[model samples]
Target: MASNISYKCPTCGAEIFWSAEKGCFDCIYCGDTFTLEQMKEAGAVVDQPIDEQKVEHAEEIVDGEYTQTTDGTVSKDLVKYSCSHCGAEIITDRSTAATICVYCGNAVIMSEQIIADFAPDYVIPFKVQKNKVMEAFKEFSKKPLTPKDFDCDKVVDKMQGVYIPFWLYSGKCDGRIEGEGINKKTYRRGDYEITEKRIHDIMRDGTVNFEMVPVDGSAKTEDAAMDSIEPYDFKDLVKFTPAYLSGFLAERFDEDADKCFPRAQERIENTTRSELEDSAAYDELDIKSYQKKTTIEKTEYAMLPTWLLYTTYKEEKFFFAMNGQTGKFIGNLPISKVKLVLYSLLGGIGGTVVGALLGMILG
Candidate 1:
């Protein structure tokens, strides 16, 4: 009941895949070269909703027209696909967009993965190469006080590139804030000091338009860790195409965009408050009443590139993540107890010598 969706070279039967090195789909067997556009022209790549009716087709059927037989060859909710190499069953959940076969280690691109509503609008591909992970890791571990026992070599070698799902949101904020402020001035008259204080009620109302505030849509990813690596360059964001996911792994968004709005609003308000205070010339401001009205303008589902490494030391698991495009790494390394003790001893000796010199001087 499964489908084999491996892309192969036209001339030779060997599997041709997207190569990050070549930046295109290339065949290793017969030395055939093809681009994603070329494959789309050759009917090798397809997008759901059948956008290209201009090219010409014999028949067109609505999405609901496709029926799944009892054999489970095709269905909307759950699907079973077979590996072309081993004929083993490859199961995929409804939201799982793409994955590789565990049995044969071959790529399995589900045919009906992206339907009308579940499709992504943009994709940020991996700009970081496989060989660059270690360089980034070593740079991250080069701190002066880093533990001597922490090993960077073993962890960096096994780094994995995963396309994390994120929901990009835009909103408009109309905020009205009212608060009491205090102004104080001090003056010296002769031998006495006189202070004058003025208490005033202040009110401000403004609108803050936020564009492309992101929240991680996958529950598997830590929200703080993702936020630590800030600002994915949207200039490089591309229209989503399954061809771009050829060599990488991606997962469909499990959490809806609407669910991410609360966090977005909180962040927007915090930023708006800072901006308002910076613009104001008040001596002291305390916001007692706040009214923030927000409307979500846009929501987009996309796959963003990330490199994650997991390590365990002393029976404790550690996590490290790097923004694949920018190669910005964030992680905490363990401290060495031996180094800590030695530093403490040296500090104690220095303190004792300084104390003895002070005693002799006082005597």
Candidate 2:
């Protein structure tokens, strides 16, 4: 049977969760904070490895039938674990690493999912607290053309801190670019115009070494949205510990490293080609041929922090995401047709009044 784990305050016996503001686990009831080393010393952080034989046996039994509850049949992909705090049954898909129990609102970490080969090598814990994220989101939704009926408070209430899984790739790229550089000159001599044109063959070649090129490991996350929140500062990364996942929701990698390598490769190749082209330094460069090769040196699995929310306006869903480390927010807001028309009418009226005043002055 899969087991659930929740960090508990040693003094108050209440559930403790990671606090972004405090940079440690905090007890809401006792107003106490505990660091990673303190928790480990208290015996609160213990590894619970799943037994492979039992897991294989359970898989065989639940193969086709899944597990039928008294109420109804559950999907084969979904697994159920009892929440340690509330004893309420928590059901989640294979990709879910941690979640909050709906009944009691206590954080629950599925121990078996994040142990052994599935564990992440590094984690960037949430640095921006929920209140900070809320403030930033309010500023983001302050566009004049936004729909008045859209409730920012409601979306803010639904915001969740998630540790998104990513694959970090490091490699070296070598490439060459061959192009034609053209120069043109024009002058007037003795009342006669003369034009000169020169073309020269240019070739540039170089190598670029890159580290920590990130590609998200969740299929549900949009590639474009993930790309927009680029350039996470990898210097802040800490060794992965379950203590860091105490409060926030986390997802295991559904798409493995092999599946995500192509994206990293594409990014590296494009960067290498651009570097070579820049080195050529021509007024006008037309590329005739480009060739490159990438060799991956290292690949690591990591969990990065993000604040995410979803809301629907006029039946169209909108997604908001923020970089938990840097607080960079990104999302699309709905435009109010009424406001648009009003602004257009006001502008037209003002323009006509200005034109009439100019005509009177000229007459």
Candidate 3:
């Protein structure tokens, strides 16, 4: 991973940007001070995944389903950190540990609780590094209606590398669901009566082999914005490596895999149901009942990538997100009120003048 990514502060909730000039992290909150080296010493640990020791791995997993390895070689776990100064949390893949709080700007080492809660399955290296992210931010601020003093430069300092947690679920699907449907028809006779029929049918009995259904794992992420930056480049996913996480910041799932899995299952079921319904077509959809129950086996966890930013105008915050792998931009944008009013008023006055002139000419 490239060096110099963003991080969050623990004491206060401000997003802290990394500054090359400062060299050391400058916390805007609580005025705590620490360097990357100091934070690293406090917050770094790595444990390799050991498949042979299932019991040990199980013990390590504090909250969710333990990700077991059959290889006998245990996957290593790292000591992730949340900024004591700013309260921002992160997981690092590589050994170099110290980090500045992106929010409060204090130095922080990894915490044991953060390590356990945010353990992730894999990571996507920063292909579009922190600098690139800063560049993107600058471009974004240049758009119309952005604050007059909105110095993209200042945002750069606030830009920290964030590894938002996501759960990627994949497994064989055998779905079954039950729902009632009604079909009504009328006969155009003197004794005509509306005939209504209740229909039921089995939705699926066959297996559906699915891959990479993703669910958000971080409460910090906005649901709508996260969803908009979808369709990651799964092909670019590399084998799990902490080196990929070096110089950047990341989060392990606060939401456990088991809890998060339900969301994935829901998405898969919905997609599968739609597919089945499509096969039944509207004209041929003579149904009495619909039952679909999906059994998901052998689910695997992967981390999909996202680049996100939050901006505020007139106290109203706006979020923007990009698919880190695919570079698909998705988010809500606000129109400039001043510009809108200017145009509206100009059009109104111009129309009134023209109407009066035409009336006089016609008379």
Candidate 4:
């Protein structure tokens, strides 16, 4: 049976809304404990959509990111609470009592520092189901030179569903690069070899636009793991809806807009450099030196979708992720030391025997 979940404290019949200030769900009534998902599933808290008439940019802004202080009870309202246990920003309803702290898992309540930012402009649904993620991991482990126990089903099953926040920027760059190239020619004159060097002025410039370049916001996730799940289908993004966040843990952006801006700039600059290099052609190029100037006219923060799995092996935690829309699988798998050594020894011995047998047969 499919039913809407509620966020209520399992121990107490109190509604627990999330509080960014406290970084946990807090109960105003009984001081109970529960996360936002727990309370939302319990029918204790209800989110009323914003009324279009009240706000000028109601539809333009992302949900949870904006709040018109005067809007009379919209479908969505800015919620704030504080965890009394720990001082952390929590963003949820007043009914929320307990939630895992982003900084630390210790229970927290709403705090005073919680503030609102525009909600994500877009979201990608969990297209890659959990079972498929496990299968992908299993297949990943089976590659040649991979550990024998790398494909362990238990490790695959440990994967979890977490929605990570990412920012995507699109823009065009007009770049100019100057560099030097050398050409060498060999000629034999009376048994003498001559080499000539030619220096040329190379000027390369072009306009290249990159759409939906992704920058991860969650500090818990590493750049390498996220990059592994490349090629998210940004074309399928839908307006951010809390409904889509169902059944998975959604993490708010830990890094502020300003903090994340550098990443966007870095991605654009890197892309622009690559475009310039690709557009230019040079032979025997030592690239004595090169200088590039790029201009980014426009940029926007887009919430690219991702699913994260945090698991532990031998007491060490590791994360795996899949692009929610494109189903790109990414994460590092542990190689069993014993299995790797055994496989290498066996492969080496087998290769030596095969080589000897071939040599003997030929002789």
Candidate 5:
């Protein structure tokens, strides 16, 4: 059975959401806040073990087209749950773990999906708030080449904080690099320049250990967009709790840890090779042969904080993302052809005037 969970203010029984600024859950209706410990003490949070049978059943159901329910027929791709706060129906796709009820405007966590095998092992709470993200987007859109008709405020309104699922990989790498080192010496003797070259074979072997290399586990997110806003501070990583997901959108991993490990392996191998090559001290090095072997020691599932916005300009879609923890923002803004032409003409005229003035002065 599908179940929905929502946190309520103890005083007024209104919906409460996690506040990034206060590091606690706040009730807008009652203006009261509660910490995770307080919520637990109040019997608001409880730990549930993974239900392996439910996980298998969910997998079977999603593999079909539709499912028959007591109310009506629902698509297997989407799951329907009733909002615990208002009894309104909440519809979500299979990947969605947390979302807001459209009718009642209450945060709903899909208890079954998250408590199954898809539960995260760790999570980084949001540090940057929506207002800060809006300010950052405003600054980002101020680039001179951006499209004139683009509306920053509209996109800001749609901005949402999400806990992106990631697979953290830890491993050790053993690698060896063989190359030729070249040295060149040039000297002037009696009005004649003499040059001498020396070349020598060099080899280096080393082992490198890496921890917490992240690869996004959701296929819906662009790989490049996720890669751009990286380097999350793992020190802030805490044990996963459903309370951290309140007031935000979250997705369960569609791509399992095994499927995402290859990317992490490649990154680890490339870094190991670079480290080995750097240890070979040489003026000019030409790598002739290289070999590497990587062994994955551990893998962990975690949810990292991110703010995402999607908009379309001239019928082309654009995406922007910010690191909720570090405030690192990245996106490709649309470049206006009209502005490019105007700037080019201005630059050409300015260059011509400067060249003429410099020519006269030198003459």
Candidate 6:
């Protein structure tokens, strides 16, 4: 077992925790505060992932599952941290990430643990407060079609602030597009209406550049749910610092940056094709063929803030996510069937009334 890492107050010799509200690490005992730079000067190091793929001894294992030995000899790759509040032995696979203490209810930072390359180039700190998240969740539950028990403590208590891994990709897409379109001319000829139809070949070519396109690098998170809460304003992004992770959980990238390129490639190619189509004016357009080539310019790893709520319905898990920085919320929620039917019936009646009103006006 590895020794636990603690950030002691340089002035008081007491342990400290990161304060999200204050944007620094503070000692609960002596009331001393330290910034990331100050903490590094005080012997605190960056936290990094201990990938099972990279470590020959530490194999991947699910959470809550551990290896037990009779004689008590353990793998060199496994590390342990003890909670100061509860004294529970918190064991983590050499995956090198530490989260909240299950024994006590406080965030644990394994400072002495060896941090690695999964370290981010940038980080967006959490802007939304915990109370605000609970308030927003209450508002979200007010939707007419959601389950009635969404507000229960069993469902609402599990909300967490996690810094999710993202790979930023920037590239330029160059392409040529050739298609067919129709041009129409209509004019009045005395008492007769004259119409002319002309078909023309459309050819377009251009170079389109995309910057800071993000792809989630964590395998545990669903891609679509992560993407749904996007438009993370990059203006607030700052240099990656471990001080920002005081009360929150952050996961290291499980996959490489190059592995994320296919998604970015598809996104740029689709955008390039759309841009080409917008260049032509047509009454009717038919796209025949378009070919594009993509060149990736830059790739970097980073962490973004997210508020996640997990609940189980009929023994199956469900997740709701909100962008911690921008407050965009999305979830795969259970729908109320009675409410759905009622809403459908109301919509049908409303549509029919509007149709009757339009007919009366036109006739």
lDDT of each: 0.65, 0.76, 0.49, 0.51, 0.76, 0.69
* Candidate 3 segments whose C-alpha is farther than 4 A from its true place: 1-118, 147-149, 175-205, 281-288, 344-363
Candidate 1: tens digits of C-alpha lDDT, residues 175-196: 8878877778999999989988
Q: lDDT per residue, candidate 2, 1-363, as tens digits?
A: 345566688778888988999888889999988887787777775334445443311122244443322112244576667776677767666667888777888877766667777789899988899999898888878866678888898877878888888999998999999989887788999999898878899998999999989999987676777777766899889888776787788887889899999999999999999998888766778899988999999999899998888677898777778888888767776767787668667784354644443232210
Ranking by TM-score: 5, 2, 6, 1, 4, 3
Error of 4 at 278 (Å): 2.9
Candidate 6 residues lying further than 4 Å off, grouped into runs, are: 1-87, 91-96, 109-114, 188-195, 281-284, 341-363
Per-residue lDDT for 20-89 in model 5, tens only? 8877788899898888778777777434454445432223334454432211224457665667667875
How do these models rank on lDDT, best leading?
2, 5, 6, 1, 4, 3
Please give the lDDT score at residue 175 for candidate 1.
Answer: 80
Off by more than 4 A, model 5: 46-76, 348-363
Question: Considering every candidate listed, which one attains the maximal TM-score?
Answer: 5
Residue 112 accuracy (lDDT) in model 1:
49
Per-candidate RMSD, Å: 10.7, 8.1, 14.9, 14.0, 7.7, 8.0
* Candidate 5: clashing residue pairs, number: 0
Angstrom error of the Cα, residue 3, model 5: value is 3.0
* CA lDDT, candidate 2, residue 153: 85
Residues 46-75, model 6: lDDT tens digits = 343334343322223444444221112243
Superposed model 2: Cα runs more than 4 Å off: 46-77, 184-196, 348-363
Predicted structure 5: lDDT: 0.76
Instruction: Indicate the residue-level lDDT of 166 in model 5.
Output: 95
| lDDT accuracy of residue 316 in candidate 3 | 62
